[model samples]
Target: MFEQFTQDARQTVVLAQSAARRLGHHYIGTEHLLLGLLSQPHTLAARLLVVRGLDLAYAETTVLRLLGTPGLDARDADALGTIGIDLSAIKEKVEATFGRGALDRDPAHTRAGRFAGGGHIPFTKRAKKVLELSLREALRLKHKHIADGHLLLGLLREGEGLAAKVLAEAGIDFAQLRADLDRDIPAVPA
Candidate 1:
């Protein structure tokens, strides 16, 4: 599958991991993939996103806000709120007991064996799905090679991940973007 990836597409995948690590995230999610694509200026994905008003700085800020410092997902906190758990109180107690940076270590580092190492950041299930779907999208388009736009297409179709959520929060028109991507990029001629 990787063999079918264009150079920029391959770089996007590599950069996704770096993006996750830079953001102190334990897993590489679809949001990181979006960041990865945005980080590089040379790809078709980057060009289209920029032209459509997807600002990298703004996107990064939104992601970080949504993520909210390592160890706590804003969604999880909201969910816990429904049960009156008081995550903020818990956080205060934990910090008081263990001092700062107590839960700072990324969970990826604590996983056994293949995921045990500090430097190894694995893709979340959804991110992995995006890559798989990218291949499927390229094949469906009758293209032998996968490109960045195909990856972006996969990201859109995945639909339920953080990437999609972030895109929505940033006011990106996913339906229109998808249509533009599907129409503007042509499959390689057979």
Candidate 2:
């Protein structure tokens, strides 16, 4: 929901959409969101992810490998589709977590026209759903800042989503990751 998102959250969504388009992906997978988080120049999400040792470049490489496309250049958008990523699987996970109703009511659509500076990349249904779930979770926790951790948690709750599966394939256990987050997240300043 773009309306409910703080500026940072909105930026993350925009970044995710851009990453999806740049990668020529029909659906915006969690990996795209991860890329989005990393793309931000300076944000808490970016910092936290780096501090936690999640290497964006390495992860991107792994993602490309998982897609069956290795050593593809970033400029080769044409080569992206051949990677064979499971879009349906990622979409199914997003839908299962946010539900169809909430997703359909995504506020990003209302604010679509607002983003005009760097070009507008439309969000796919799955991306919108993932953003919605992430925003809602942030709101639920009374968090004023929507960081990468929130996005990661949203993916985890998606219950074996593409991002979660990717993390697993990388030997990063979700349970352990969550445990680390729990142990590491500093209390929000009052």
**After superposition on all CA atoms, what RMSD does each candidate show versus the true structure?**
6.2, 12.0
| Overall lDDT per candidate, in order of appearance | 0.80, 0.58
- Tens-place lDDT per residue, model 2, 1-190, is 4565556656776777676554545456777877777777466556656665666676677665666533334445445445865544544586577542222332564356233223455655555566667666566677765555566666666644556556666566667666665455333621
Q: Indicate which candidate wins on lDDT.
A: 1
Root-mean-square deviation of Cα positions for candidate 1 versus the true structure, in angstroms = 6.2
Task: Point to the candidate with the largest TM-score.
Answer: 1
Q: Model 2: runs farther than 4 Å from truth?
A: 69-125, 144-147, 179-190
> What TM-score number comes out for model 2?
0.58
Instruction: Pick out the ten consecutive residues of candidate 1 with the lowest summed lDDT.
Output: 109-118
- Alpha-carbon runs more than 4 Å astray in model 1: 70-103, 107-119
TM-score of each model, in listed order: 0.75, 0.58
Residue pairs in collision within model 1: none
